[model samples]
Target: MMSEKILEVKDLVVDLDLDLGDGRTRPVLSNVSLSVSDSEVLGIIGESGSGKTVLSRALVNWVSHPLRVSNGSILYRGQDLLTLPPARMQALRGRKIAYIGSDPGSALDPTLPIGRQIVEKLRSVEPGISTRDAAARVVQVLDAVRIPSARERFYEFPFQFSGGMMQRVMIVDALVTNPDLLVADNITQPLDVTVAAQILRLLQDLQRDFKTAILFVSSSLGVINEIAHNVLVLANGRVVENQSVGQLLSTPQHNYTKHLIADIPRIWKGGPDTAAPAPAAAAPEMEPILSVRDVDRFYATKDREKLFGKQIVQAVRGVSFDVYKGDNLGIVGESGCGKSTLSRLLSCLEAPDSGQILFKGQDIANMKAKELLTLRRGFQLLLQDPYNSIPPHLTIGRTIAEPLLIHGVPRREVHDRVTATMHEVGLSVELYDKLPVGLSAGQRQRVSIARALVLDPELLILDETLSALDQVEQSKLLALFDRLQAQRGITYIYISHDLGMVRRACNRVAVMYLGRVVELANNERTFFDPGHPYTRALLSAVPAIEDRPYKAETYLLEGEPPNPINIPPGCSFRTRCPFAFDRCATDDPRLRVRGLDDLAACHLQEINVPAE
Candidate 1:
């Protein structure tokens, strides 16, 4: 890290005008000042609506929507970007300064090939560069970001790529122009843990190799701690504290910062799985409400050159698990780990290719249309993107009542049930008439929960439902989940990439990798006494305050995951496992009981691992 400043913000203030019934202007940002030096990373930490995004946009002169930079000086390389000429600013955007957004799926053009998109972005900034040179540059950056089959994937559309691959494309696009300063705007928000950590490491490497100053903006303090040398805390658009990462983390001077740190879902487990808490007193004796028996789901991928795409994507391999009446069974893993696919099987939304998913002792795959509908009523699903899930034009009451009305519940009792469910989920009756746009994020999420609970389902499947929420809202919703479980006796299946969330809400967890559950144990054994290397790696990726001074060397998983369509012959994780040997290369290990409360599918129990 160098002392020479690369970018600076002086008294930056941003404002947005709302036209919802009443017109009002609010400060999206206020008197925010900070600087990033060459080869240094500055982390901006705050919650949603805290102006972190707005401030980041203003830095790059990207104020749109109802938002505008009211007052501030955005100095980049000793010049005010706020007042710079449009042509000059455009020239500076990709060549001298770059921006990578959070949602890569939306960021890239779905219609164009990835390589062509990169070439266009490059040529737009450097019109004088030759086409051949631009294409060459594209390949270089793609390889830099570790995109497998870079040359071949260059011609594929955005939809062909996964979330992690698209994120890598975002990074490659941003850095292909060789910008002097990079503004990473929540780039990792859409990624799973392992991919996010990998991207962070990539950014650190890019900084070292290119000497590019990075302004990292995110809502996660742990993400900030991972790569940032300096930390800037923001609350309600005001600068709360700006200090070194060490000082900010160790001796947080501001109360808000302390609260932010405290809210991070801590991993709390070390006891046995048999140690049932008071809320789940009957869990040990209860029969499973749902059982998955060697279920398999496959998808076909498009073949670029072949006339018929014959490639098979084994999305969910033969997997089995059981969900008790009152247990919160958490499913955790990186992207493409088949958690979502399993949720669909559990919810009766889709049928598996083989094997059986028994809900209330009835096989889902054999269920008739009417039986499926009945099953859906008793098994509800809560999705991650509630904004999209809740129809925008529909009123809250109507949205909640749609399910009940479809189930042939008498019209007279529908509104009454909706009202009761709204109250049950902690929503005010007044918001019933309002559209989804009128409610806050937390409220919208509550409305989502209310819609699911309105059915009074015995089994609730929350698939990354709380992942979009901030720490405080997540905590509140978690508490609501607990109360709902305690009061209504609804079983929960929380599928999340957040282990901390799993630790907090789940009694038992299944850690999946490459479409297989490598470890199955209660929260305590899963977090504290993990028998699988992948489980350990996932746990260590979390930034623990107790284990401060984050280092990149810790929790490093080398090489990219193998393609699901062409899985490795033996141990699927052997390519990245540090303890892999001759046995890992030839034989596969099945999930075996390791202790009284856990199962591990690794050769670690068969061999000794020498600590470095």
Candidate 2:
């Protein structure tokens, strides 16, 4: 017997109200068609601005103001939802067809307890359910999504939760109603690899138990490959290819689909020191550009309102490293591993509690404000969220020119620099007057790059700058970075969880864990022969591109990192290190030479026992 169709979108066309003086509409999605069967997984894959998101919203008749489904029939359970009454649509939206948006923060209520919000959701769908029973259900769903101590956590406000934990709460909220079709839109985009893998496993388990049809929308093919049975590839608001996961990945038909698949950087495999041909003997003469020595930064939590007391958070602890003038040093670690804080220190945006940060042999803290301003023009930071990084209200011209103007460049020179920079970064000159909201994520990121390059910075501190982007855009930007480096001899300190991109872009890599660099080496040695157990675990968490039986690779970390407020004694990573012994608990291992350039902090290495 054939399974019933749960949802079907036919010849869907969505348009955005340009709100131009003439009141014209621009088509965002054009002639898209797909269906989801009972207990089936339909994956939507696309680059940013490809209408993957718009189509998902359009399916539920939930397109916001200025954006509407102009042409299409959205059929749900054999009923055309476009013609359904508002009241009927409302009834089905939350109870039968639930939506968990990409950003978990948007779905949650800040003032209300997470438990209360979920219980409210439960009661809305099932009015006869008691408050006690609703809360119990909330707790059950939370546990199902792997929220530890779900019963106690239910009472906590969303502010108390981490990004990953907040995401778990959102999943629980969506599933509490047991919706027939769950629309999970890029739910794991903001997560670390380990957390993302866990969430994927949770979803797999939930599907097995509930047998609910799911529309899994994401940009990551690796993710789609693991979860979805079939994928619909979208580009320029139109369907490019629709095929089974295996067929689509192995043999993508369209050029757009092929480019998207090919652009995925293979982790630890293609670096110069790996399978790729080595570069000709490198230039040796160099004084260090930035030398970070025994840097310590502590953050004290405001404990005035807390019941217990205030706490001291050690964000970066005695971190030391040297960055050469033309070096592209990559920092890879989980979210709380102090990589971001260390980046700030390196950029001279924050002061360390102790130790010296020398920029060209001059101390960052000791430099005069005027001198520091001049120095800062040589190094700029590019953040993860391009939208938030550039002020929304500012025109692109003004946004790019702000840095140039601030640096005392002539007005004419500022204009010239901004224009040249914009063109260099692949942005149209016509967008100069447009607000950031009108631009795509890739365009906005280009604006960011243009702004940074306008001042001709010698060093760029990229803190997850490409994490928010789709693969196609990442490929373009990675190429841009490479070109910029080659042309200007610029340096880059890349702080990212994307090991693949890191290996592809950087010659050297640093692995941090709980505010310390546990491993340091060239990207190839660090990846292929990782000495630290934490580094190995991170690599394992990434999904394999091959058709190996896809078991979630957790490698051996049992739990999340210990809270920075009260880190354990001795080696910080010992708590999760599988080969850790009593000595690991008492003696903190320092970076010891494993190779001419490779260094790792591990007792196993010191004892000359190779990690499996």
Candidate 3:
């Protein structure tokens, strides 16, 4: 332990009013307490609505409006945060303690360049510093996060960088002043597994290198297991359990903690063969709702005449798959792996370059405008961020009803449908009039779901819909999905980065890498006995809540995935796959049935195969 305690939060209580239409108050977060010491990494893990994010936000006196500290003490180095004068607290913030939130793009100023943002922070903390000196310091700090061309990148705006790069910039900005304590809330959710792992490793190295304490917050327990020293399990805004990572992993005293670990998507007892016996061989079988055959999609670059610039990005290359009525198909991969593109192709949002997309045995590629509108009503997409998908200004009722209106539903019918959908999604009719901005993240997500369900779509495309949610909220939505599936036979194309969630939510899984399907299998088999090397690496990359005695040596991919346009000739994953052989580079392996209810595309067959 260091001589100075970085932060000590004691008996912190935050309360929010649900504004129950007429007048009602509901307790959000009850009494909570935790502490972080110098050089220590403290984790707060729980499901959505568990109050972990709230508690962290309150620590910085930046709690969202309508939520306030009803009672509690946030003591940082002997100073009470809740009682500090506004000016004094503002001055102390970022200098002594800083917060790195979930979305760096949202945190960063959009119009200014990254360099200017860094310079502003440096100047704010050190008013007397010269511009030349500040620019030099900014370059030094940017290099610390491994951002290439540190001096040049400072002049680039947030939008100019990729999602991963923006995160690195935000991290550099947070540490610019060398704050003693930092609160990182789901900071890496937007990043791919490889990049996420790199970020965590960097943070771990920084903690040792700089001796800065961190309050690491996330919904995923596997993420918590990687870098955290101590763990605090929060449920409904109260601390349910707290311990060192080793102790928590080995012996979780709380039932919730145990359940969270157990709920992690893993190979079931029977493994790949555990897909409910394939529906009794389908005696009274219905026709497949969606069938994609020989799908090949390519996008042309803007500069076609320049050398290596006229390339076409192959998004879905010779992919063939089918979705049976009422079956859930999960697509899992790193960001930009073409899950969204494939979803749009299935929904007829884009035509394949040289393939057939059949919806109900009919080609939708050339559907008439009216027919297209009708087709859209049969399949709906649920976006990841409800904020962007759900309009904030409109009341919940109007948002739900707007879809029905566009479909030319009668006014009376639209009202009835919207109200019914709201009730079905666990929202009261009274909440129908509340704007989305007034609702919690969970409630807003629920509203978005209601809006989608209001159209009564048979097939729903969940494009990482639950990624933004915490665990508790995610669990609720998962249960809701199960209910909707069972009751309405609503099929789903569930796309997600969180493999555990995919395992829990999907019956069948499809693994994608560099815009190609590398494997498809029953969920159990995919998790336990993945046949494809890429699938194995992806599954291995998933953080586990329970730490296994043996940690496999990680095969971090050598470089950024080859440019999507000029992808290598064979096996799209060959560039990053350790199992890639001479044949793998020249011959693309087609999806092959390797086991009962399992398909893999790689030439190699092994678990945790070493990368050369």
Candidate 4:
């Protein structure tokens, strides 16, 4: 039974200029053909620079900068989207085919109140609708996302909302008009696993209920396995493989797809810490390298809003964790859940509002002068966006060498260390002189890691560092981190929303929400038998690549995570928890041992022992 066709693209050829010393035109997407149906989710998986983004953008007349679609026929419902006039295309952008941009804030106007922005979307589609009526409609759409106080929040500015809330608002704005198709381009990368899963569930429900088609784009195969009915793999501006999700997962024809599937971590007979037999047992027991104790971080103003007064935004509520030598402590949470706040505190990039962060039993919050400079060598941070992390003006060599030079490493050894570190990150020496603009996203990320590693820090703080890298690059990098850990005992504080990576890469995992650690457990136990409601939600959200089908569980956590500022008393997760009771709202659960050195802060179960 063939599904009703919603969109079709045939022999799409997009041309762009290529500089061959002189100037010449080059075809970016050649003979690209694909289609989508009303009842199907299409997955576009690709490495960076594979023209996946370009091809997707071209669907909505959004060709990236300097890249124009010289030739392509994008048909929507038998109507040509490519040949449509500018005004017609603009009208079709939101009313018929919606786009949920990668950056939620940028997708929405920062200056406009979220409610007004959503209302404006309604008014745009139905110009005859009055402002009051549109406002009511806006509330209804926001309510669809289960955001609390929708009516009151209409006037709230985008900056006032957290990252997850902002994403929800963007989704509401996109869906308010009830578009036929939605294009989500890596929307969940900035969100934590729990919230990321909730968002995916919402999308799934919306797709099932509203019959909306989706072009879900992501670099993670695990995520694609969850939502996509069919998958399309792209690399270097070309399609590598396009098939049903079942075909792609069960028997991937491409080696790239196989690498992608293998990259996602799975539980073996033993746990994550169980070293390979080939590596022998020479590895020593790692000791505590960096410890964070009861760290609380917040951002706000001191003024009482002058006359009306200002309120302080609590980014990180009181939280505590540790990183041991050769250990990777994966902090998983949605964006704006204070994961980065904790990272900044550990790196001494930002100080906590309260509590002591002891590095080697010495408080780093109060480090001064030369001591601070010396302490920096012991810890370094690798950020998510490589473009922002590295100076575009500097060559790769200089970018990596700058850290060593700043620390007064000898000029002779600087080059050696930089080259060795670059190779460690899978970057070739030929790229040593290339600027960030000249490198691919994956290569640029490698440069970022190389720069961080050249300093020889005892601890590495990876803040979604591998988020932008493709499957192959990610696997190579993970292998590199593993080798570095085994050889040098370098500890890591890995902060990411991707659970698959966390499961494969980290020794232990910590789940965070609204500025607190909700759960902490080993990788195997965390996935197979989650102790906390939030942890279970996160695990259930992760899509497996194996043959098993996905079951939609009703363990729904409603409402956007509570505002960090003025967070409700007792359990922070209670407002959205499906199992929460009156007792949960009054008494906060302390972190306590449950099973096999695992700890979770939830009142539902005092001691949860995993089934054999």
Clashes of each: 0, 0, 7, 9
Candidate RMSDs in Å, in order, are 2.7, 2.4, 4.1, 3.5
- Across residues 522-577, which tens digit of lDDT does each residue of candidate 2 receive? 86687677888888888777754643211234363544798898799888887877
lDDT of 4: 0.77
The lowest-lDDT stretch of 10 consecutive residues in candidate 2 is 274-283
lDDT of 3 at 509: 88
Please report, in order, the local distance difference test score of every candidate based on alpha carbons.
0.84, 0.84, 0.79, 0.77
TM-score of each: 0.94, 0.94, 0.86, 0.89
- List residue ranges in candidate 3 displaced over 4 A: 1-3, 14-31, 63-72, 81-91, 127-137, 148-155, 249-287, 299-314, 410-417, 432-437, 547-552, 556-559, 583-588, 605-612
Model 1 lDDT, full chain set: 0.84
Residue-level lDDT tens digits of model 1 in 1-612: 337888999999888887575867788899999999999999999887788888888888999868888897999989999999999998899789999888889987888999999999899888999989999989988988888888888889998888888989998998998888999988877678878888888889889998899999988887898899999999999999999988998899999999898777666423344233523534556667898999999988886569886788888988988887888999999888889988887787788999999888889788899878877888899999867889998999999999998989999998889999999889999888888885767888899899888888999899999888777778789889889888998899999987667777888899999888999987777766778888877876764444522223655664467888899988999898866888899899888888776788887764544212
Clashing pairs in 2: none
Off by over 4 Å in 1: 20-24, 268-285, 548-555, 606-612
How far residue 491's Cα lies from its native spot in candidate 1, in Å, is 1.2
Q: Give the better candidate number (2 or 4) by lDDT.
A: 2
Considering only N, C-alpha and C atoms within 3 Å, which residue pairs clash in candidate 3?
47-471, 47-472, 48-470, 48-471, 48-472, 48-473, 115-154
Sort the candidates on TM-score, descending order: 2, 1, 4, 3
Q: Distance (Å) between predicted and true CA of 332, model 3?
A: 0.9
State how far residue 294 of model 4 sits from its true place (Å). 2.7
